[model samples]
Target chain A: MRNLADEIERFILRKLAGETNDITILQRNELADELSCAPSQISYVLSTRFTAERGFIVQSRRGSGGFVRIVRVPVQKIVYNKPDNIMDYCSPEDFENIIIKLNSERMITAREAGLIKYFLDVIDDYVNPVEKMRIFRSLLITLENNS
Target chain B: MRNLADEIERFILRKLAGETNDITILQRNELADELSCAPSQISYVLSTRFTAERGFIVQSRRGSGGFVRIVRVPVQKIVYNKPDNIMDYCSPEDFENIIIKLNSERMITAREAGLIKYFLDVIDDYVNPVEKMRIFRSLLITLENNS
Candidate 1:
């Protein structure tokens, strides 16, 4: 990572993490001055790090008085209702249902959902349903763990 | 991979590889007829494997006489020509350059690049530079190997 870009991202992340509402608005010039980088650099950081697919909504307007607003959205709703070995017992339909729920909740983007749905469809065609369930379950568990 | 899907992918790959130009056009119905599979199955393979991120450009038309077109794009023009063990010898700037190129080439979605770039930033913050290079090199090498 470029040090400046990373610094800008972390700086924004820290600001967002500290906000209870999960929203932050800041000036490009002020942040650039603080970070000792050009304002353009801050814009690049915001555009890349705070994207819609990454669960962030960014609103910005041009002009000196304008500010950049970023809203952090949850990537997933983590609820462990099942036992520890969830993957061992879940069905493919269960996987599909949970993914649909997550998508509905805006945890993952529609593009990702499409990609994953196609993957599942292909896996279903080749693998046994039971084995496919295991794969999907493991993937969900991994995402949860990572989250 | 599903046996039929794999076969179809190989068929397309062979067609592309054999092309004097880096483009191929074929009707989905014709492919399905040859493979003895549903036309939708051909779509699944095309959408997944021939994605822009995977260095492909796909164009399609619908209705009767519609055709699916595939274009093979170079991925590695994004970066290369470093030493045999460049990751062991390069700086974070090198890593950033590679990723930026990949993003410009649409080899990875911006969200993925942001995730990676942010992770690298945190790693740079806490980890020694040498260790960071090793990680960066390893990621690039893995991608190359997989490609």
Candidate 2:
């Protein structure tokens, strides 16, 4: 049996996949009741799985009108038919698409994909993955704050 | 005389080197008993040595059918060598030399080279360095495991 965390993560991702770009607001108590899990369990799933590093932004308002809002950030997509063509003349869009495909295909490990996403978001150079992730993260922060 | 932790660490590294994907899973208590050390010693070695920063991920499950899995994250390698002839393909030995040349030129980082070595062991493909490394790492863990 899948853990509650994984189940909740899949539920949120399934919902996010159906929509293009929008914030999904859900009441914690209602969500918890539906999942038959504690409110803290929902919080744990959100914090760990739906992190900004994974191309998601989550915000919450606590109180009687308490609700968690999740936004799926738009990311670029790349397509290649053959493995030999994977790295040829990659544009920013191409890189993002490659990452999206890799993640969707479950080709790269989650941690490895996270590292690559970080590079795409931060690094400017067409170089190493570690540096790439760092640069991508920096760029993302700059873009997010400015826009 | 090697400490129990050192012995166990060496044993794990040897196993990793012999394998293509270089990931090893074992039971903590079983390994500890075999090494004549406390289970905490295994944890100590894992914490000190097999860290994400050190290119290893340690995951464990507690209780029935529990096991500790150690996965080594291969580093990425950048290669700049290109063969002249279109028809004549490079052998594994030729590819190995290309890696050495890149390493000597300081074109590829040590971590990148390590990842390349891991990739070479896993993927059997003939292509340019950038594409070869990219494709290999991109699909290393996913392809066979899925089926």
Instruction: Name the candidate that leads on TM-score.
Output: 2
- How well docked is model 1, in DockQ terms? 0.02
lDDT, candidate 1, residue B54? 77
lDDT of 2 by residue, A60-146 (tens): 898888789898653322133535244435556756766667567543435445544443432243445544434343433333332
Put down candidate 1 lDDT per residue, B1-147, tens digits, no spaces: 136767889999999879987899999989999999999989999997888877788999999888998987654434555442444545667777777877877776665455446546544644577766665554544443334
Interface RMSD after interface superposition, model 1: 16.8
Give the Å shift of residue A64 in candidate 2: 6.3
Whole-model lDDT values for every prediction? 0.68, 0.59
Count of backbone clashes for each model?
0, 15
TM-score of each: 0.33, 0.38
List, for all models, the DockQ compared with the true complex.
0.02, 0.04
Proportion of native contacts found in each model?
0.00, 0.00
lDDT of 1 by residue, A1-147 (tens): 569999999999999999876778888898999999999999898888887657776777665357788777553322233334344544667667766766654455554455445445545545677666655555555444544
